[model samples]
Target: MTAEQQTLLEKSYKDFTRNGALLSDEAKEELRKIDAALAVVKLKFGENVLAETQAYQLHLTDAADLSGLPEGTIEAAHDLAKSLDKEGWIFTLDYPSYIPFVTYADKRELRKEIALAAGRKAFQANEHNNEKNVLEIVNLRHQRAQLLGYSSHANFILEERMAQRPEKVNAFLQDLLDKAKPAALKEFQELQDFAKKLDGIEQLEKWDSAYYAEKLKQQKFDLDDEKLKPYFNLAYVLAGAFDVAKQLYGLSFTEVDTIDKYHEDVQTFEVRDENDAFVAIFYADFFPRKGKRNGAWMTSYKPQYWKDGQEERPHVSIVCNFTKPTASRPSLLTFNEVTTLFHEFGHALHGILADTTYPTLSGTSVFWDFVELPSQIMENWCYEEACLANFAKHYETAEVIPMALVDKIKESASFQEGMATLRQISFGLLDMGWHGANPSLIEKVKDFERTQFASTSLYPDVADNAMSTSFSHIFDGGYSSGYYSYKWAEVLDADAFDFFKQEGIFNRAIGEKFKTNILAKGGTEHPMVLYKRFRGQEPRVEPLLKRAGLL
Candidate 1:
């Protein structure tokens, strides 16, 4: 235990020095002040974004305004309006309300209005605007990087990631861009042409993309999210994930109501090994609420570690905002939400399986680029017929998802994958453009973004809209120069899952190897070494490219 403590202390001290602790006493004092100010500024930046998101609302009294929205969406909107003591539907910037409207609403003008509102979230001239905040945040980051003897923020951040420098990150993104751009352009042209044919619209704008793409997908695959939702009820999907975990790792989960929960929607469970020994505590919070933030993520309240000759267990939680259960139905998840649950459950499994000696080096503390491999790889299971057979059944009828629908899901897995890859690459490139070089001379955020996006730009630009102002991942979150890691980890995940595919998907030996080698080991060694130890070879990009149909 003492040795373990010593190791953690050493790592913490090294990290502090690597950040800026070796500076002169005066410089160190200034660094402290800068960090304190940065904390306040970042907090304010996120708060401003949330406030702005909550502040805007499109209150509708006419049925025509709600045209083309899903029935579930209309019901939710009516509930919101009733709660607010209004007469008709109310739509906010929340994704549940916003996404369906943009994707299915027939009123292009309304879609344009909501999309423009979403895009220009913190870019407005109101008190919640983030223009000055963005400038100050980036300048402070650059200043901190220089103070730490790095040329730029990307250089400082990438030092600890799989991609070790700005140039390498840029090259990785560009290589993917070169492969994906042609296909992406062709896909865009097809989408535009489809919109023209379907609605007599001459040009398809950004707001029209999802609506048309969804329509086109239905036309091609004869599969839609609503048609698939009945088989993915939230409770059953959670059970499916647990079953997969059990089959893969010999773990079991049982709901225990005695544990205190933070919210009514949260479910608590006791995890156990095959021997019935306690493993970890898992909490799941699904469904959207006003207080909780958007997006799904896994977090650990107590990390698994060893001390005093005893192994402590972990408490892991997965939070998400799925479509809430309406008055007439259970909480049925869209196909995308099913994959999301699996993704986050994968992260929780990482925490639950942690067997490290030191808390600091425990689960999910690996390299930024490597941390996503487990989560993303788990998503692959959702597309498998073997896995889906366990828990994918209709909420009312109890009928399993048809083999035909499963086949369609697999067939359409890589549909328009090139365009999707290009979109992710664009975000990564934009992140690099901000942090890879000096942003000292960039006055207008939109002007700088236009240049960064020049290579990836497809549709006509919206003058009032800017992405940088609300790009929380790079600015307020830990992804500053690390957005590319999503793609970076995709490569790792594709390669890793290929191993499972080689052996049977449910091969116990392979599952045990993965749990012990990758999830349990955490940040104990360099990520590349850990990954190679598990896979027995360096990962090849061909697997990822092939999976995405880029090959």
Candidate 2:
């Protein structure tokens, strides 16, 4: 058998034994109970978070309360209010509503109100509170890990991941924390000083972070989403993504009308390679509406695999909550949303290019720590002038995006990156705190989180806000003890992109190397081996640090 087949067989056997196939009958029964309970509590945790998000509303009747908001944001809020049969405007805790309010709203008290509301989701004294759920999840996960002969829940989960052990993950995070903390502290002081000078604010609070950061960014770079949105019509940005794919990997995307979609908003496309051979079916749904959750992600309806000497192409989809087009204007995206589109498209490309034999190891069915490499690396293109020149045109004038703005976008890329890195480190630390050690004695979720965040804390803590209560990525989603993978993959992406920059961003030879060794290979080999095959060396942290302006 081939080495890939051997690896798959060994992995399948390990999965069975790790899941308790080798356990005694009595232990198996206990494991079953634990799994069942985990399922119920995880569902409850997510439901409570969603309920809390939908329950709160900041209904505004005064026009002055909307100061500093962009026109599109105001119009969307007005439309929301009209739909709810209210006056003035309405804003919910959804990203489309909440992010804009915190980032751009000039009303300090109002921003604080919404920010606190967002931070307190599922952490309040109400039916939707998730404090108990958080405790139950960690304890149950710990118990299950011990039952499976692992030291901690993180140990059990990490065994199947690139990190492989809790200690390695901890050391990796701590190394990053050590490198980032000093820079983060310096950035925080600068932001505080700027906030005081700009607004005469005495002390910065959790609510002030986004607003002041946006202000400081604008002051430093003269760049803001509102000024750049005109150049990033959603359709144009998407076409730019397709063009990058075509240039990089010789793929084509053609919209089709025959495929049935779950929503009218979903657009279906047929993806093909250079020779006009079918590759994959792509589905894209972009917009916010009732019942649709916030955030963006890529998912697959079918997996690509070779069966009976026939290769089955995959069906992949990207779902995002970009702003909808209003009657007066087309759907213009913020620079952040533009990167998000490319990120998910990168994942779709992974699935589209899969050429593995086994279904289980196809496409994004790779290590938790390595999966983000494709998505995050794609975001680098959004900042590239060569890539942006293709599709970033003004909606009204058809003018290409100004080079000055492109330079600003690249300049601001590392603006407050220190603080950002620290924030991610804090989350990774918090996740490790819950699963890396025994949690049976963890009595209070907020207290536990506070202890975990003590090293990474920036703003003064709000007693009422407990992040773990609403952190569905670990409790309800697949992240679990793997939140650190985001930073881990950043290291890989930075190193990989550096190779492209050395060769050329659009170098077809380098692109084909990436597509063959990284995208098409999937989990056929270990992630590090595949990465090295493409990059010609083990990934480096220097590139990430240098790019983030930490070095």
User: Judged by lDDT, which candidate is best?
Assistant: 2
Error of 1 at 261 (Å): 2.1
Candidate 2 on 118-171: residue-level lDDT in tens?
889999888899999999999999999999999999999999899999899999
- How high is the lDDT of residue 513 in model 1? 88
lDDT per residue (tens digit) for residues 1-551 in model 1: 45436557766887988767789998898788889888988888888888888888988899988777778889988999999999999988887788888888889998898999999889998888888888888888888888888999899899888899999999999999999999899989999899999999897899998899889999999988878889998999999999989998999999999998989999999999999999999999997887677788899999998989999999999998888888888888888889999999999998999988878899888889999988999999999999999889998899999989999999889888989999999999999998888889989999988999999988899988999888888888889999999999999999999999999889999999899889888777778888998999999899999998888
Best by TM-score: 2
- Scored by CA lDDT, what does every candidate get? 0.89, 0.93
- Score every model by TM-score: 0.97, 0.99
> Clashing residue pairs, candidate 1?
none
